[model samples]
Target chain A: MKRRTALKVAASAALTSVLTIGSAYGAEPIRFGAVAPKTGALAAGAAITHWPNIQLWVHQVNERGGLRMKDGSRRKVEIIEYDDRTNPGETIKAVERLATQDKVDFIVAPYSTGLNVAAAPVFAKLGYPQVAATAITDKIPELTQRYPSIFFALGSTTALASSVADVLAKMKAEGKIGNRIAMVNVADAFGIELAEASRPIFVKAGFEIVFNRSYPLGTQDLSPIVKGAKASNPDAFVAWSYPPDTFALTEQSKIEGLNVKAYYTAVATAFPAYGGKFGKSVEGHLGAGGVNTDTAEMKAYFAAHQKVTGKPADYWASAVTYASLQVLEQSIEAVGTDRKAVIEHISKSTFQTVMGPWKFVNQSIDKVWTVGQWQGGVFHGVASTGLPGAKPVIVKTGW
Target chain B: MTARETRTLILVVVAFALLACLPLLRHGYLLSLGVDIAMYTVLATSWALFSGPTHYISLATAAFYGIGAYVVAAGIGTLPYPALVALAGLAGAVAAALVGLATLRLSGVYFVIFTLGLAELVRQIVTWVQNNFTGSRGMYVLTSITERMIYWELLALAAAVFFIGWRVARSRLGFALRIIGNDETVAAHLGINSAACKLALFVISGAFAGMVGAIMAPRLSYIEPSIAFTSELSFQVVIMALLGGVHRLWGPLVGVIPFTILWEVIAARFPTQTVLLLGIAFLLIVYLIPNGVVGRIESALRAAQRRVSHA
Candidate 1:
């Protein structure tokens, strides 16, 4: 009897879920789908950098009575979301499902470089335009050639690597730093690509790489890496790292007192939490991605993002991520919900975004904020690929 | 085979034939889920072939799977797809045989720990090799293999694995392994070559896992050590096998089907809360169905039969 009751309840619960999933919504809202690593090792970072921005975009669009269609009818957004759990297999399956089953009008690309690459084929096959805002790979030319619909907004590994190299070289010329350098990278796709790109560029810039090493991703003990970099006594230190490792490496550097005039780290160094945690000590600390937070456009974007999501946007790719969405929105509005039309429209157009008036040449954004520094409690864009209104780099005189 | 066994075999074939026709429907989502279902079916069923009767509890599924993915990543353009898959299977078998010979001596927890460590070791080796030899840490398997093709490959592999499992369950080797699982010393005393039996089955399991990995690689497109050799996959397979009652030949399927669907639903319904819900769901499954769905059904049937007989 007890078992029968349990069975009855289970059956009804399953039935309800099926109904809810199959239920139609009002207003014929334009369906936007996204598969994010919401429940994995990358979840925490995605929470801050990826998911919140997506929500903010949705909220803003819906508040403005959705996207304006060509017929002047407004279509609100209804999101079909999936937690990828950070598995590539799961990521692929979720994207495929969104494309085929849910049949969403638009699909947002997954977070991080690896996942974006993993699901690119699915996006191509399903005729969805994958706006890969967070993906940073040097294989942009090849990828763009292959997947014509997929757009990479974040600058390439080569672009970023050269920027770091350029920043260090500029400092050396000013006698702020020397030619000797210490470098470490997280041994994953993102870090490895950057490191490989930088090696040739750094050599060409007449800088001797005094120390170079790579630690595996998710490695907890970073003291050895920090100590090793310090032992070389290099004038500049750079770590092409992921979020957790970036924080860990910075903490270890502070603990070990590994002083280098032009210290640079990647990924999470632009995070607001990084600023909140280290406070004044992070002033002049260089990192990946610089934004002119002082710009009125940027100021408004920041305000809207914080107001909607109740979280501050990161200094680097948050705006970039939001900008990719803006590009998608503009394309969709112009071309309607037809996937091919949007892709073609996006390929040949310029978009006014939070990151400024952006254009995709060869389906890739060329200009990007490659290096940023903390100045007066704000991560300011110190250098870029000639993005308008970038600030000058500030030297790290102390911890 | 007995008539009963023949009927079961026919049913299996009919099911396979129906599943083979899924691509014709061209429902992209169903086919995608089919690929997942078939992949896990292959992994869990093949896993049951060795770990079921043997009870060795090997946690090295990802090692063989990663090896298969890497094999495809390394050989995608140069070699034909089928040949790459075959080579991956062979590679997995060879690796398993080597590991089994060395570590199969240690039973229970010791073997589990060693097997868990094996995937990490292989991943590091792959990462090092890629760093030193290949210019990139990750490789792209840029083939025009469609999702339908991947699903079919996995479905065929699942059928082959299940057929092998059925045969192994009724074979002399199966009898010996069951005894070994019960008591290794007693099995040896009973004139069973326990080590050899365990090693043979382990190779078969690893081979299937590797084949599944190779077939699924194109769907992934991007191949890196971390993506290929996620340790979570190993644990998931184990949990699935346990949930379905690994002792039965077709038990893992019962576990895989529901788990995969439930996972999708939970992930969809509660995107942010899914992780917490997943943990809760697993705890509930383990607690409520400790003996597994198959075991519970078998026991209930036995009880009903006894009641009817008494009447």
Candidate 2:
């Protein structure tokens, strides 16, 4: 009877010690879910700009001992990711899974405007603060009204269009280019919105629309569009293109000798691969969303990003994406893993990130980095309209 | 009914009963997955309803599907969901009848090319309408319905398609279709009214696909021309049907479930190589089991029975 009592006492002590140690060592991980285009047409861009940044952010946060919770305990981030396949349907399904099935604490936004817009309702319904990193749209007022938890980190479409128009207007005034302008857009939400916004802005700036065309998304051959624009012999060319078509249009333009003093393409024109592919030919080419690479913070961020991810961040949305993650992290650290608290914190606070200080004004970024140009193999901010960094726009040289 | 028929009916009833209880699972991701699988099942089975028995290789699934999606998008606020689904079915049947009237006379590669061209034509027209008339880049449908409800709707649509397919497979229409598939010239010589039968089946098939698209549109919430008219939709349905063995009624169901799960798994695990892996797997399946998993399993079971009977 004594031996039996001692055995029971020893087992109880062992179990107690085990329970205490386990409780002390094992705090539940804060789960962050993301749905990005890991495959399909947008996969290449996502790899460079979206996924790598997320990976880097998660790594850095964990390395720094995770998020400092409001209750004074630290929890490591546990990332749950899904590939949206760059399809809106897939994106919606992924978001639904993240919110309902995985029950992630937070969800990073998908990459593009169309996807972000499509997913806004789902996020709003689930009460997630969707800080969209690459969504550029003109319908901010409507979207904000519908989805109060959604925020656009990228600049608005109107701001982008007006900035480009302003640069062209300045060029026209200086006699660097003629008033005739050629514009072509991909027939999708992102391209269509930009084109619609820019048309009136360009006309108001005294530029005659010499050639205007819209091609379907995922179009393989852009030779006809480039040839048509060249036949018109416009003094400026603007292509509101996605990544694949951006590269295709530039290639076809060079082959067709479609020379214009002011050449601009959207999306992937700021990609490092773009400069690498075009070499010196891409110098003086203009794109959307440029970074002031000379800033010490920007330089360090780029260096660390390359070192960590083993891939170069693009000149445009990569920094924006990383900054959005920073905002989420800051919000989470400030208020713990409670999503409602995170959303409230993000709405009220300003965060200093890779893109400098970011504060939301009515769910849209107050400052916009509108137009960028490739000069001497580097993308420079040629027109930062509502933002600080600005460089003089240079006339694009012939390929 | 024979014992085999009774057993089959009971099994189907029980299967549907279990599927109806899917909402009880209460996993949002699984519900969404069930909805997707149900959508693909409807599409694949409907495609096979005509194309399987006729061997016409219709590539116009996207056209009908896109039309149905657009109809729902256009009538979102004005019409109820059930009403929109019926209208979408009517629209699909009418469109299919028209397309069949024009292209049914053509056979072999010409029919395939015409159907392929039809999808592109419909897509361009929708794009034009969206750009010129609506001036709306995208259409959003506000729905108070839950995902569970959508899953049930899709499940019902899939069950309907399965029932229709099963009935047609046993009826005179299915016999006529098989004969026509085997040899159109011989079927016509036998006074089968091959053209009329083919066109009717085509219309029926399209109606089911359209209903599925209509049901799915509200779930998507936002519809753009590009999303609605993707050729990938047609290709995916065709692949699913072919992968499951188009000749059998349950082949599409078998194909859709596994492929959908595989897709979710591969897409999550290996996002970059999804297409490549899926392509390789498809090629292997085609090489090993040309008639699909159902066909292979059926063949294996028959051989086993024969061996047992001999023993």
Candidate 3:
């Protein structure tokens, strides 16, 4: 019996050794896993947000002799990314595979709000601390309240909406804007949440929301929505949209010759592609953003980002992604290894990152968030600038 | 037992033991790769039941999978795991039967297009359903996951599918289905009940596919239209069956393991080049091994014997 057991064990061990040869090929870098859309509709946004700062951070850290460990040793940061293809199911599968199979030290969740929401419980159950870079929703706070191991770098949805309202109020007080507005959003959770949150804010700010509509994502034609919003004769058009929808709405608005005095959008509006694509038409447009050259820290980050990424930082999503990496770095440094200790480290402490300072209120829930906007090709930080190092950049559109 | 029988028994026992011990043996990426193998094997075997025997290709296998997933997710109210899985399979069969009835009259590439069109239509439906049933966001079930449970579930499902494939290969239904595949008009003239065989195969294929999806829905703890129903995944099923020598019992299992492992290795190390390399490999395989990896090897060995006999 003993001999049989011993032989079986030996055979298993041999197979295991042969299988893990790939793991032994490289020096154990800080094994980090990222869930990004490598292909599909959102591939460009995914690349811009997930890859750039990661490469930048990896370069900077390698320059400083890589990640510092508790044992006074250093290892280079290595990222293994799976393209979720902007699919939530794929994202969850990738995260699980990363957690149970690759056993990476840290994992970066997807940039899509939907993808992140779908993946939250999986990460939480595995006791892996997932830092969400792009998923910002009102539901996150409640989700965080339940899970405690998940963290969001940005301000919560309510806080972000209130801050946008504050900015709009301030702009109005300064006589730069009026009370008439039209709100158009994608018929998706992220867009719907933003529109819902903003509705109350707009009401509180005493602005009449003349036209409000929720259109589907990936909808080819937006002429109807533009025409309707145009006919509403609003002072500003507030759009909660992704790149495709943003471009579609912008094109349709231009085609229809809709003369809305001001145009503002959510997500990816700060991308130079937007400005580059639309040019003079996009000059007076406003969009949400986080990373800008307003502060020394931000300026330094922008320079580093530009040098490494070979492009200007687009939006706050990229900064949030970088900040997530920073958290992963700190946690790994504190715990020495990734899996069990990393979560514990992240659960109980605060870390400084690209978004200034992020401190989780409860380790299980997503509590921290903020809102940003683009002003003259810059993502001006308008909300959640109360962190230790955050510098607010307030701006007015149609200048 | 005869030597051949004993050899088969030994191989079976060894495979079972390896599957049982997979979790204990490998962790992280390797373990996931193993799970992927099991998943693909199940998918291929199920797909082969329809395409191999009856010659009716389903481009909407993934749509049935999505339907199964969404139903289970939506119906998780008070059902047990087995019950839920059964329900999913039933739903899939019903869906396949309904679609098959409508399109079975169309033959050749038109049938293919109809199935493809149906799959796309289902995709749109799921996307629309996602808004109401699973929220505007992606659907997630907040629950605990055990890798061991998933691994074993997949193993059990694969074994069940292997048995079904074995029985089908030997049964009368299998011969009728095979005749239909070779020449439907001839089989129909000879009173083979062509439509019945095709519809039966279609439903059987859908059932197996649905069971796999039901297992997968809870394992990943999430589901979406695109993830549950991608053309790539559907193609992978056919690829595995083709590479392994379709219509054979062990073919899909054999094909999926090596290809899946190779894919993982390439994807992990050289992600940008993985797809390109796969394309090249596929081209090479088609040119060199027209009958697939297994068929080509057997043919080569047979050719060598023929040469020796001539000598």
Candidate 4:
């Protein structure tokens, strides 16, 4: 009697699951593919900005029973992942694998500026919409024209660099700061692009770049650099830096008491640790990447990100990455797995995301935060091309 | 020519014919893998041509490779593709000759250190130039060349490298280099111009590496100092040559195929731990096959012949 009851229970349980799933959505899962630098120089950055966002997007989509189809059927999303080892060759290979070997329905952009640029042609040839979020280069106008299917969410190097100059120029005009400024950059693609783009803009804004030097990316002791910048006695200091160097420079600035009204660093300035470590000191500190975290929706996003990834979403490109996914998901939902149609839809439609309603004009983001400031404990939006919800710039009282 | 040389010539021709048709499958992944193997084969074979006979263990493969790529990137629109490739090869040869003349006096660890530093030194100089002049970090290579085109060019380059290596192995320079590799002082006493022979072979090796780099620049789509002259590439080429056996012209081929497939599998299976797994795999290869698979297999065959004669 006991054996018969157990068998009957298993049959009914299996029958119910099959009936429900078959009735609601009988289509195969849409296989989404992604590549990131899970191991290498950008591994830490990828962990914070790339992989976790992908996971969260996948979870959110599945929570809604995958994407709703055109035929009143729903297909679940199944993700195929690859770690590019932070090598461009590997990135190309992994993307090719996703397109040819695995036959995934879509491919997400690789992380970092160099890598996204490296893998752009592969994505283009394979007919995948390359929505790059973390990549920031000044050559977007040329790149987008060259690769029709590629898109850039992060603003250009010229836009960000000029924005910094404009902000500092406003300070000088207001008599809040002098025309003299000190600048340092880590000698890599990101740092070099920003630093070089800023030079002309700084000159145009009538600012003298008193101390401009570049140290290698992983330089341990920033004392000499700090000493040189301090000797220049500028009213502002800026560092076009990556994460490790950002933290090192900030710590070194604090140690050396390099007092300046406008202190800014790039990349990792949006990281929660920047605030956690510097706390009250980071107030009025300006950096790249900003978010208006006052809204209920933005708060919910932060909560969900923390809950899912066990870390706060970075104030910089993390939202831009997620917003790109939202755009991708919506496009795929409207027009099945047709790559061309999906690209067309994304190119045409306005997407309402955590960052707000926006559309790509000429295959580029219409608006993006050029710079963000640390106000109180949040990374508040201080400037953008759109200028929506931008907070007033605050003066820094030495770290 | 000896029967062995004729056999190797025919076998290399057959291998080239087989590899050139892989892109016909119309599969991106397979074609990319073919590109990987052919690129590595050329790099390792050419590297062994100089380093194997001299036992110099030069790690400047990346330096030449980067020079080749940068040459193409800088001169793409100004010159034709073939011209750029030739110019890249010439540039590499000239650079190699200069470096070899200056640093050939050092040997063993000092030579290794110099060659290893060469890549970084080149990278730094390139960075400084770009920073000061172009106001950009990297340049984009927007060309009509497809992946299939790259694969074919690389395969053709591989064949050319193998043919040159085969000829050099039978040449008088090869004999002198063998003596120099065994004992440089002894070779000098025997009236061998050891320095010139080494420099000649080094130039040839560098030229091949440069051409390969030019062919591969489009695959990366962009060229930067760090990407063009990555240190990992130099070490990877060394590992491939060592694994195949530097003593023979065909040894690096013996190493490149297995390592390429094993790497693809490891990358897929353990994506997050690729570096760690790669370390473990290298350790195993070194421990089990120190003299390389080809050398070990050749020795084993000779031992079997000896046993048969005794019986």
- What is the DockQ for all candidates, taken in turn? 0.53, 0.33, 0.17, 0.50
lDDT by residue for model 3 over A1-399, one digit each (tens)?
999999999999988996685365344677778877777666788778777877888888878887888888877776777776665555666787787767777777677655776777667767777777776555555677766667766556566666667666666777666888888888654665567677878898888899988677678988999999989988778888877888888888888877655577877776767777876666556566545446677678878888888987766677777778788888888887746777677777888776666676664224333545555565555554454333433433332
Residue B100 lDDT, candidate 4, scale 0-100: 98
lDDT: worst 10-residue window of model 4 chain B? B129-138
lDDT of 1 by residue, A350-394 (tens): 999998899998999998999999999999987888887877777
Candidate 2, B1-311: lDDT as tens digits: 79999999899889989998987987667777888898898899999899888989888898898889888888987988889999999999999999999989899899989988887888777766655455454466656667788788888887888888888888999899899999998998999999999999999988887787788776666676667777878888887888898888888888888889988887766656777888887787778878888898899999999999999
For each candidate, the alpha-carbon lDDT, in order, equals: 0.88, 0.85, 0.72, 0.89
Determine the TM-score of chain B of model 4.
0.97
Off by over 4 Å in 1: A1-27, B131-138
In model 2, residue pairs whose N, Cα or C atoms come closer than 3 Å (at least 3 residues apart or on different chains), thus clashing, are: none
- Residues B244-300 of candidate 4: C-alpha lDDT, one tens digit per residue: 999998899999999999999988777777889999989998899999989899999
Ranking by lDDT: 4, 1, 2, 3
The 10-residue segment of model 3 chain B with minimum total lDDT is B129-138
**Which number leads on lDDT?**
4
- Model 4 CA deviation exceeding 4 Å by range: A1-26, B1-8
- Candidate 2 chain A, run of 10 with poorest lDDT: A18-27
Candidate closer to the true structure by DockQ (higher is better), 2 or 3: 2
Candidate 1 chain B lowest-lDDT run of ten: B129-138
Q: How does each model score on TM-score? A: 0.93, 0.87, 0.83, 0.94
Most accurate candidate by TM-score? 4
Ranking of predictions according to TM-score: 4, 1, 2, 3
